[model samples]
Structure formats: C-alpha cells, structure tokens
Target chain A: MRYFLELAYRGTHYHGWQRQPNGISVQEVLENALSTILREPTALVGSGRTDTGVHAGQQFAHFDTDLTLPDTLIRSLNGMTPSDIAVYDCFPVAPDDHARFTATYRYYQYQLCRRKDPFRADLAYQFVFPLDVPRMNEAAALLLKHTDFESFSKVKTDVKTFNCRIDVAYWEQHPNGDLTFHVRADRFLRGMVRALVGTLLAVGQGRLSVADFGSIIDARDRKRAGRAAPAEGLSLVGVGYPDSVFTQRTTGPAQAF
Target chain B: MRYFLELAYRGTHYHGWQRQPNGISVQEVLENALSTILREPTALVGSGRTDTGVHAGQQFAHFDTDLTLPDTLIRSLNGMTPSDIAVYDCFPVAPDDHARFTATYRYYQYQLCRRKDPFRADLAYQFVFPLDVPRMNEAAALLLKHTDFESFSKVKTDVKTFNCRIDVAYWEQHPNGDLTFHVRADRFLRGMVRALVGTLLAVGQGRLSVADFGSIIDARDRKRAGRAAPAEGLSLVGVGYPDSVFTQRTTGPAQAF
Candidate 1:
C-alpha cells in the first residue's frame, strides 16, 4: 500500500531533504525511523528537496509498506521523530498517487526581516536596509507571466527542464517589518525561488530595473540573473494538486493544531 | 591602558557569552581571536554572563593592554572578531571603571510567537495558542510596582539578592503574531526573565489569575513560580551605564573589516 505523509521540520540540523552519504538528511532519518517502526525496509520519496538551512511550512512524502499500521500512523511517527521534525498527518493513498509528479502546483514563502532583531538572527534573513515592497511585487508579478525560468536556474543542476508556470507571485507585509514573498508554480527549477528573490531584491533596492527583469527572463541565460539569496529565508508553504487527483485528500483540522 | 568595548553578538551558535569548558563560548572565541590579532594575552571582563543560546543586543566588556593600538579601535576589534561577534564602538576608560558594577540598568526582551511561520524555529520560541496580551501586560505592570520577584526567580542560584527596580515592563505586539516582553531593571537574577515570561504566559493562558500575580511576586519563593520559558525566546536588548562613565571615554567610528 502507498501512503502519503504530511511533514514539517526545522532544516537547520539536517543536511537537506535529500539523502546524502556524508551528512544526515531528513529523508534518511525518516526512512530509518519508519523502517524500525514498521519492521520492514522502506523507500520514501519527498515532494521536493530543500537545501540546507531551508525550512518547510508544509512538506509531503510518500512510501510503500506491506505491514499493516494503525489508523493513527501520524501519532506513532510524531512520537518517534526528533523534536525538530514532526509528522502532522499520514494516510493510505491510491496505489498510483505520486507525491511529486501528481502535484499541480507548489507554493513557497521567503521571509525577510529589515531590522537587526537578535531573535531573528538564525531564522529569518536579516537585511538592514529598507525595502520597496511595491516594486518587488511588480517584479514578482512579471515572474508569474513567464514560463521559462532558465535565468533563475542553477547552472550546475542536473534537472531536465527549466519551465514552470507561476500561478501566484506577490509580496505581503507583516506588521513586524517582515516581508514575505509568496510564489506558487506548477513546478520550480533547482535554485529557482532563491534566485528570483535575489533578482527581485535587486529591483527592490533599485539596482535592477523592473523592465530589465523581464529581459532577464526572456534571455533564458543563467549568467544574466543575480545570485541566489541565502537558503534560510525560503520555505515550502503548500502543495496543490488537481482536484481529480486529490479527490479524497484533505488536510486534518487546522483549527489550532 | 584600560579599554571598554561595546559589542553585539548573535549567540545561537555560542555556548554562552562567558568562557565554558563544555564547548566553544563567545568570550573564549573572542579572546582567542583578539589575542591572535594583538599577539598579547587578553583577559577581558564582561558586564554579565549570558547563558547558552542567549543573544546580546548591547554588551560591554573591559580589557587592559600594555601596548598601544590604533585609535580606530572598533576597526581593529572587528578585524579580529568573527562574523557572529561584532565590535561596534570601543574607547579608553578609567582604570576603575567596571562593566558590571557601573551599569545603571539592564534591559531584556522575551519574545513569544503564537504560530510557527517556518521562519522562527531557531530564533523564537513558537507557542501554538494565542496569548491574551492585555492581560499579560496588566500582570507585567504589577511586576514593576513591586521589588521582590521571588516568584520569577530561578531556584538554587548564587545571587546576593532578589531585589530589583523595574524601570519598564510591557508586552508589545509586533504584528507578526509575536509578543515582545520588554523589561528594564537595575539588574536581573539568573534566569529571571525566562521565569517571568513563564509566569506571565501562565496568566495569559488562564492558568494564573492576573489579580493574583502580585501576590506571587511578594511570595518570593521559587516554588511559587512557573517553569522557565525556553532560552531561545530571551535576549539581552540593552545595558545602561552611568552617563559620566561614557563622558570621558572617546571611541572611533564603527567600520567592520
């Protein structure tokens, strides 16, 4: 049977979501813990790979197991996982359900603090200078109108495609002087969100004109883009799937949990 | 010559502001770094000891040196200190000046987050439920009206006294659904702010009556206090000294190398 796990974690301690030989990854730890609990070898695939120090508001992964587990699968996983990692929900899925490919869109949020608050030192990326949120939103809106994101793609990545349809792109201000950039797309290229944030920040700081941002996307040249922002500010917020594919899928009660 | 250094540091990676044997400390690292740069043995005395994972928004320390360094002391110190530790302003002070004793007051901020934003995992302690800010403020107001804070004092601590005059006590909402408890006092006992936040949180959660909070302060017994909040939510925001101390002290501009 196939099962989907809704998860979230503080990525500061792990190497990333993908498995690696040298450092501990979230995937490896979850797989090891699940194998012990189910008493069977299991292979799990995450919906996305978050870089080291990148967080996730909501992340999903799927695995297959022959053992019959209790209905409260999430409770057992939550009890076994480290305090930094939490499993919020788990349920059996259709045998063909895919956590990654079947998703229609994935959303991400990048949090930025404009002041030097000591409490946000390790969490939100602290940028001392003032920001132009309106200009940033304009640049982000232009991003949603484009499809080929080659300029924002990491040059050395092994991904086969650089195309993505961004359905939503905008910036919202929190009362605490934090600016959150929300961007949702059918898919994202490797390092795409971070790179876009870097370019948008350039526009926000008046370094790059919004008109120039459009050409950068049209150029589809990685060298034309600005450097990627640090990973600490990025987070996977939500994932959306086609209604047909996710007919029975529903989030558990979000009323304070 | 005797010198006093005004510095700020993000203490997330540090064991504490003081030298420690368990792991690398902020003071030890600064000592080693400054010693290596100046090629002299330096033993600096700080205003106070900040516990592990506790940040210093404004910290002061004094060091004596037999050799004469450049007048641009901030530049020299910044060149020596790590990125996590920053030296802002430095000046020559009277040999009798004491960082801890000469201080008139010390201010601390305890932050409480109502929700997990994926951006505050390391920087702020995430409290799930909403807190009644106005009630907590009323209880905190009672704290400033009293001198004995035994209910907010940590147990089994080596302190000469638990008496303190709170100059300011208030909790302000930062619009990010996080509350900041700002308190200014002549001095704070060990774990005082965390303990105070614990009790105030209890009041906010309906665990303790707001009217009864005053009696808890008068009780002065550690057993009457609530559990200390996590260290991540606490930060030393400011340290105030007599104006006369900084009057004669001349320092150079802040220029980080």
Candidate 2:
C-alpha cells in the first residue's frame, strides 16, 4: 500500500528538504523515522525540493509499505521527528499516486516587512525601503503573460525546460506595512520565485521600470534579472492534488485522536 | 536625556528578558550593544521581565545618556544585535518617564494550535487535544472578578502584594484551528499568565470545572493551581504608558530612514 505523508518544516536548521550528503536534511530525518518505525529501509518521494532557509506551510510525500499503519503512526512519527519538522497526517493513497508528478499546482509566498518584528525576524525579510504595491502588482501581472521564465531560473539547473504555467500572481499589502507576493504555477524552476520577487521589488523601488522588467523577461538571460530574494522570506504555502488520488481524507475529527 | 527604546525578541535562545547571573539574557545583550555603540556603560529598565523562552512582541526599556544620539542609532543597534533581537525605535522621553513603574497596562497572549505547523513551531504550543472554547471563556471571565491571585503567582516572589486588576481576558479562535488567550492587566505577578492559561486549559479539557477554577483562586495557594503553561507559548504583546512620557513619537515616516 502507498501512503501520503502531509508534513511541514522550518528549513532554517536543515540544509534543505531533499536528502544531502553535506548536512542534515528534512527528508533524511523523515526517512530515518520511517525506517525505524517500519523496521525496514524506507525512502520517500517528495513533492518538490525547497532550498535552505525556505519554510513550508504544507508539503506532501509518498512512501510504500506492505503492512498496515497503526492508528498512532502520526503521533509516533511526530515524537521521533525533530521539533522543527511536524508530521500532520498520514493516509492511504492510490498505488499510482505520485507526490511529485501528480501535484497539480504549487503556491508560494514571499514576505517583506518594513517594520522590524522580532517574532518574524527569521520568517520574513526585513526590507527598509517602502514598496509601491500598485507598481509591484503591475509588474507581477506581466508574469501571467509569459510562460518561459528562463531569465528567472537559476543557471545550470537540471530541469528539462523553463516553461511553466502561472495561474495567479499578485502582491498583497498587510495593515502592518508588510508586503507579500503570492504566486501559483503548475511547476517552478529552481530559484524562480525568489528571482521574480527580487526583480519585482526593484520595480517597486523605482530602480527598474516596468518596461525594463519586460525586456529582462524577453532576454531569456539569468544575468539580466535582479538577485534572488533571501530564502528565509520564501515559503511553499500549498500543493494542489487531485481528489481521486487520496483514498482517505482525514480532517477535523482526527485531532480528537 | 532619557531615551525610550522599543524592542522585541524571540526568547528561544537567551535566558528570558532580565539579566541573570548564569545564562545570557536579552537585557544583557542589549546593554552590551548600547554600551559599545555609545562608548559608555548603559543599563536599561525594562517594562517587565519575561521568563525563559517567552517572547515579546513590543517591549519598552529606558536608559540615560549625556551624548546626543545619532539618527542611525536604531540601525546601529540592530546591526550589533543578534538576528533574534530587533530594535524597532529609539526616541527621547521625559526625565521622569519610567519604563516599568509608569506603564498603565500590560498585554500578554498565549497561543495553542491543534494542527501541527512547522512555521509556528517556536511561536506556539502544539496540543492535539480538542479544546472547548466556550468553557475556557467561561473560566476566563472569572479572572476579572478577583484581584489577589496568589494561586497563580510563583512561589517565593519578592513582590509586596499579589493583587492584580485584570482588565480583559478572553480566548480568541482562529479559522485555522488555533486558539489564543489574550489577557490585559495593570500588573502581573511572575508566572501569573502561564498559570492562568494552564488552569483554564484544564477547564476546557473538562478535567476541572469553572467552579473548581474559582475555588482554586479562592485557595490563594500556588500548589492548588494547575501547572504553568510552557514559556514558548506565552508572549508579552504590549506595554501601555501615558502620553506625557514621550517628548516625540516617531511613526511611519521613520521607515524612510
């Protein structure tokens, strides 16, 4: 049977979401816990990889096991996992369900705060400059017009193509003078969201005109784009999946367990 | 001149808000940074002291210095301080202004989340048990009826009296299945808010009744009350003072600096 593991992690301490040889990773921690609990070598196929210092509100992974999972599996996994990682739920899924390829849409948000908030210091980027929200939104709207984001993608990435279908892209301003850029796409290239946010911020600051941003996208050169925003400010907010893939969906009543 | 420094800190690292003989404290770090920047030994009188692992959203401290402060003091202090500590603003205040004694009210919040969230791992306490919000509120309302909360105060405290006037006490529920307890009072004894939250949580869990909570307060003995909630879930949200204390209140335009 195949099981889907819904999880979340603060990537500040780990190298990244994927398994790495140099340092500890969220996947390694989860895999170790799974192996210990199942009494066998276990591996996970994660939905996508998040870079170092990038947080996730919700993430999904898939693993296979021949035995039935105990009712207390989630609690046991959470007990074994580090405090920075949380296992929300584990439920049965179709054997063909793929955590990576079956994902329909991905939502990401990058936070920038003008005021210094000690609580959000690690979660948000402290930007001193005032952002022109309207201007930033105008620049963000341009993203939906184009599918090829070669200029925003990191160089030497292993992805097959730079094409991605952007569903929604906009900048939202909060009451506390914080700006958040929300973007949803079918798929994302390495470092694409952060690069787009950084370049759009330049437009908000009036350093780059909207026309210049358009030209940079047309250039298809990573060097033409601004620097990628810091990873700490970025979060994978949601991953959309088809309803048919989940064999069981556990909601509110599960908390009572 | 006396300067009021508004700051905030994530108390996960240091030994709470006050200077201690053993571990490093937020006050000690701030004092060191101030002394280094001003080239004089400076000590701060904080609005209140938070226990270890307790966060502060907005806290005030006062210190005296003879030299004129540069406009870059906030930026310099932030540069010297750790990432967990943020110096929001520094402004001149009246000589008689006191950070601790003159405060009109203090606001504290305790956060509890049923769902596991990695983003809020350090910010909130995770409890999988279902909470009866209405029952918790019923018990919270009883707090406003009494002034001497000897049951909530930590043992062997140096305070002359256990009296406290609770202005507001309520439990707020969020859409994401998180509950936050907000309490405002003229003053708080050491471990008062945490103990109250813990006892209220017991009432919500049906381990104790609302009447039992009132009896616990009437007992006026710390040993009779529930255990104090963990420090990580509690935060000092705000400290209020009179308008006469400030010589100048800096607001939005300071962001440009």
Candidate 3:
C-alpha cells in the first residue's frame, strides 16, 4: 500500500530536508517517527529538499507499506514527533503517485520589511529602504513568458535540465509595508526561487533595469543572473497535486483542520 | 571613565544577548570584536539579559574604558561587527550614567501572523486561526491598570522585585493581518513579554474569556498566566532614557539615530 502525507517543519534545526550523518534532519525524524508507528522501516519520498534555515508552509511525502494500517497514521505519527514538525494528512495513494514528478505547481514566497521588526527579524529580510515595486512587477511579468530559466538556475545543480514553466510571478505590498513576492512554476530548478528573488531585488533597489532583467533571461547564462537571496528569506509555500493522486473528496468541503 | 552606548543586536544564532561558555552569544562575540578594536579588555553592562533567540531593536549598554577614543568609535565598531549587529548610536555620558538604572521605559512588541509567512516564520509566531483582537486589547487595557504583574513574570526570575508600572500596554492589528502587542513599563521581569503574549493568545484563541484575563493579572501568580509564547515572537522594540543620557549634538541637526 502507498500513502501520502501532508506536512510542515521548521528548517532551522535541520541541515536541509534530507538526511545527514552529522545532524538530525526533517526527513530522518519523520521517517523514524512514522516507521516506529508502522512497526517497519520506511523510506519516505519527499516532494523536494529545502536548504538549511529554509522553512516550508506545506510539503508532501509518500511511503509504501505491505501491511494494512488505520487512517489515523497522521495522528499517531504526530504524537511521536516534536511540535515544530507536524503531519496533518495521511491517506493511501495510487501506485503511480510520485510526490515530486506528478506535482502540478510549486509556490514560493519571500518577505521584505522596511524596519527591523523585532518580532519578525529572524523571518523577514529587513531592507530598511524603499524599493521599486513597479519596476520589479514589470520584470516579474517576464517570468510568465519563459520556460527555460538557465539564468536563474544555480550552477553545479544536479538538475537534469534548466527548464521551468513559470505560471505566475508577481510582487505585492502588504498594508504593513511588508513586501511579498509570490511565484508559481511547473517545476523549479535548484535555487531557482532564491535567484529570481535576488534578481528582482536588484530591480527593487533600482540597481538593475527592467530591460536588463529581460536581457538576462534571454542570455541563458548562470553568470548573467543576480545572486540568489539567502535561504532564510525563502520558503517552499506549497505543491499542488492532481486530484487522482489521493482518493479523498477531491474538491469537496473537508474539515478545515 | 564609563560611557553608555545604545545599540542593537540580531539575536539569531546567538545563545542570548549575554556571554555564555556553552555557545556563541551576542555579547561575547561583540565584546571580543570591540576589545580587539579598542586594544583593551572590555566589559559591557546591558540594560538586561535577553534569553537565547531573543532580539533587541534598541538596547542600551555602558562600557568602561581607560583609553580615550573619539565618537567615531561608533562607526569603527560597527564596521568591524557583522551585518546582523550594528551600532546606531554611540555617545559618552556622565560618570554616574547607567543603562539599566536610568531607563524610564522598556517597550516590547509581540508580533503574530495569521498565515505561514515564510518570511516571518522566524520573527513572528504564525497562527492560522483568527484572533479576537478586541478581547485581547481589552485584556491589555486591564494590564495597564496594574503595577504588579506577578501573573506574567516568569517564575524563578532573579529580579529584585516583580512590581513595575506599565505606562503603556495595548494590542493593535496591522494591515498585513499581523497583530502587535506594544507594552511599555518601568521594567519587565524576565520573560514577561512572552508570558503576556501567551496569556493574550489564550484570550484570542477563545480558550480564556476577557474577564478571566483580568482576574489572571489580579491573581499575581506566575502559574496563573498562560504558557510563555515562543521567544522569537517577542522583541524589545524600544527603551526610553532621560535627555541627560544622550551625548551633546556634535552635528547641527538632531535625529533619533
């Protein structure tokens, strides 16, 4: 049997999402907790990996088991893990379900604050200066028309190709003067979101012109892009899956919990 | 001679604002950097100690030095420190000037975000559920009416006294849907802001009534308060000082910085 789990974790404590020898990781902890509950060793496949100190609002993982178990695996696994790590959904999925490959889109967000908000200093990047949001947005519109993002892709990434269909990308300001950059893409190259953010920020700071931004994308050269923003300022907000992956009421009103 | 210097530190990665042998601390690293620059052993007296992962927006400290250095020490010191920490103001004060004793008010702000703002996850406590702001504000008003906040003070704190005058206390909602509780008092017992935030969250969560919040303050027992909110959720927003504490204006215009 195969199952999918919807989860979230604080990335600060983990080196990244993957397992490592020197330190405990989010995946290792989850696997240990879930396997203990299932009474079997399980290697869960995660939607993707996030860098150290990078957080996730929503992530998905899949695991297969030969024995039958009740649907309360989420509740049971949660009881075994720390509060910072949470497992909210657990249900059997189709045999062909792939946590990563089958995902429709992945969403990411970055936060920028003008003042160093004491309560949010760790989470939000405090720029302490005005930004050119209009120019950044005009640059953002360029993302929707492109598919190959070699310029924004990290060099030395293990990704097979530097191709991504960015469905949406835009920058919006919140009332508190906090700025948010939301991006959705069919698939993201390693460090893609952070690189895009860094490039956009150059536009925000007025250091890069929109015309230059468009040309950089056209160059298809990693050296042409700006620096990737720090991992702490980025998050893997969510991944969308087709309704057929899991058999729950696809779009019905489920308990909000 | 002794000089009081107002500064701020990003407490992320630091065990706390104080020196500690177990791990890296803001004070220890800062003192080392300053001592290396000043070419003398340096010890600083901060307004108070902040726990590990806590932040200070405007913290005051006094350091004694036998060597005479120009006010440019501020710029030089900041240049040597990392980006996370900086000296916003540096001034020489009277021999009797003290950072802690002369402080008239210490204002703290507790920030809460409704959505999982990846940008603010480290800086704000993200709670998805709606908070009852009006009830929380009412409870905050009740707090302003009291001098003794034994209910909110952390137990086992080494403060000489728990009684303090709260001149300002209230909760306000920002446009980004982040809630901030601004509190100003003559002084705060250790962990008081986090404790108050936890207590107010109980009211906001509808677990405790607004009336019960009033009674909680009157109880004057640490156990009466709710659990202390996470350390990252609270920030030392500002600290007030008398005009005598500031150095004479060397330049023409007078700015807060």
Q: RMSD to native for every prediction?
A: 5.9, 2.9, 6.2
Off by over 4 Å in 2: A252-257, B252-257
Q: Taking the tens digit of each residue's C-alpha lDDT, what string does model 3 give over B102-211?
A: 88888887778664443344567777687889988888888877888888877787777778898888888876567878888988888888898898889988999989
Top candidate (DockQ): 2
lDDT of 2 by residue, A1-257 (tens): 89988888888898889999899999999999999998999999999999988988788899999987888888889999988888888888888999999999989989898867677777889898877889889989999999999999999898888999998999998876788899999999999999999999899999999999999999999999999999989988888899887648675212211
**Rank order (by lDDT, best first):** 2, 1, 3
| iRMS of each prediction | 6.3, 3.8, 7.0
Q: What's the residue-level lDDT of A193 in candidate 3?
A: 87
lDDT (C-alpha) at residue B174 in model 3: 75
Each candidate's DockQ score against the native complex? 0.11, 0.52, 0.09
The residue pairs in collision within model 3 are A119-B123, A120-B123, A123-B119
lDDT of each: 0.80, 0.89, 0.78
Report candidate 3's fraction of native contacts.
0.00
lDDT of prediction 2: 0.89
Lowest summed lDDT window (length 10), candidate 1 chain B: B248-257
Q: What would the DockQ be for model 1?
A: 0.11
Q: Looking at model 3 chain A, report the run of 10 residues with the lowest lDDT sum.
A: A248-257
lDDT of 1 by residue, B131-235 (tens): 788999999999778887767776778887789999899999974467888999998888888888888999999899987777788888888888988887777
Q: Higher-lDDT candidate among 2 and 3?
A: 2
How many backbone clashes are present in model 2?
0
